[model samples]
Target: MKYLVTGTAGFIGFHVALYLLNRGESVVGVDNINDYYDVNLKYQRLAECGIDRGNVSDNKKAVSSKYPEYSFYKMDLADKAVLMDIFEKEKIDVVINLAAQAGVRYSLTNPDAYITANIQSFLNILEACRAYPVKHLVYASSSSVYGANTKMPFSTSDNIDHPVSLYAATKKSNELMAHTYSHLFNIPTTGLRFFTVYGPWGRPDMALFLFIQAIEKGQPIQVFNHGKMKRDFTYIDDIVEGIIRVADRPAKPNPEWTGQDPDPGSSYAPFKVYNIGNSQPVELMDYIGALEKAMGKEAIKNMLPLQPGDVPSTYADVTDLKRDTGYQPQTSVEDGVAKFVAWYKKSYGK
Candidate 1:
């Protein structure tokens, strides 16, 4: 089957594409490669897929040498014309949309970016899927959507109406838009609400990468909420595995779904939502200690108040995912951090 995987230059997308390629599946990867963080890191990821960084230009297409069945294109989902063209040409069987303007704090400063990338771009993707009916449409949601909820082990069945950040709001909107498509056109849509995903080749903007960089440079690492934060730090490999499993299984209508007693997780249409997370919440201090162990250096700490649009803790209830896909996030924080540190040292020649 031919897959169209967006955000090919991103950490998760790169890993997912590599996994599919290794399994001898054909993939047409797409990315705008925006300079949201480090463009060099994005280029490095593309290079791993055998795409020459020098050869990539706006809207250009290239093939990978490492995996002959894999190809890539520099395109934005907001560009409906280009997106539609690709869909028409590639004859894509399945689509995995992972591209977006991703930082919560950044959204506070640049709200328009989220509107264009997350909202507009996502609508374009939905339209394309409607026009060219694919087998399945799998997209990324966030645990941030559970904003303002103090519930333990956040569940898909919980209400996500009160989002603390614009970024989170957009993700919730994506879920709504997906449900509309599924209801209107019978498109098989699945939304995966990812928790704190971290591992090798991770985004520099993420906490794990920032902490590792600061600790390595002997700089003080900022501890938000006075180190009272807790997260379900899921490993990248586990996330990719869950994604592939879901991609293979198209969503089915919930026969028991009724307007009287509605479950937010499923619908009468072919729409579903699942929490893809470690299902284990670790304290912030413990995560830092694990990083210190991996780097062999104690980090100078700078305790600070929690910033706006930030949640103190996040714990996911991945019961639905496990029930459906037999999914289990097996990587422990210690092992995951060690693997990330090793990759960081090797990548930067520290």
Candidate 2:
């Protein structure tokens, strides 16, 4: 099967592309390679896919030496014409749209970025899917969509109407947009609500990365909510597995779905939402402890109140995902943190 994976240079996207490529599947990957974090890390991910960063051009294709079946392009999903053209040319069977303007705190500072990348770009993707009619379209959603809901172990069935941040709102918007497409065009769409995903080649802005960096540099690591937060920190590999499984299976109309009492997770239309998480929530302090162990260093702590647009806790109830795709996040915080620190050391030449 030929798959088109957006944000191939991203943490999750890179892992997903690698997984598919390792399975001997043909993949057409795309990424804008924005400077949201470090473009060098993005380039390094491309390098791992055997894409020569020196040869990269706008919308230009590059082949992978390690996985000859894999090819990549430097493109933004916001470019409707280019995205549509790629869809038409690639004859893409499945699309895993991971590209987006990520970061909740950043959204507060730069709302336009969220509007352009998350909202506008997603509309383009939806339109492309509607026009081209792919078998399955799996896009990245977030646990943040749960927003102000204080419910423990958030279920997909729960209403995600109250979003705390623009980023969360945009993700929720993607789900709604996808549902509309599924309803109107009969396009199968699956949205995966990812939790705090962390592993090798993770994003620098994320908690794990920041904590590691601060600890290594002997700088103070900010502990939000005074280390009173709990998160369903999932491994990247597990998230990728769930994504691939869902992508392989096109969403089907829920047979039991009724207009009288609609299920938010499933619909009469070919649309579904699943929470891809560890099902285990870890405390912020415990996570920090794990990080300290991994790095063998003590962190200079700066405990602070929860930032605006930030949640105190996030726990995903992935029962539906397990039922549908046999998805389970196996990596514990201890194991996961050790692996990340190991990768960080090697990647940074420490």
Instruction: Report RMSD for candidate 1.
Output: 0.7
| lDDT, candidate 1, at 257 | 97
Tens digits of per-residue lDDT for model 2, 20-130:
998989999999999999999999998998998887999888888778888888988888999999888899999999999999999999999999999999999989888
305 Cα displacement, candidate 1 (Å) = 0.9
Instruction: Give the least accurate 10-residue stretch of model 1, judged by summed lDDT.
Output: 52-61
Sliding window of 10 residues with minimal summed lDDT for model 2:
59-68
What TM-score fits each model? 0.99, 0.99
Q: Which segments of candidate 1 are over 4 A away from where they belong?
A: none
Q: 58 in model 1: Cα distance from truth in Å?
A: 1.5
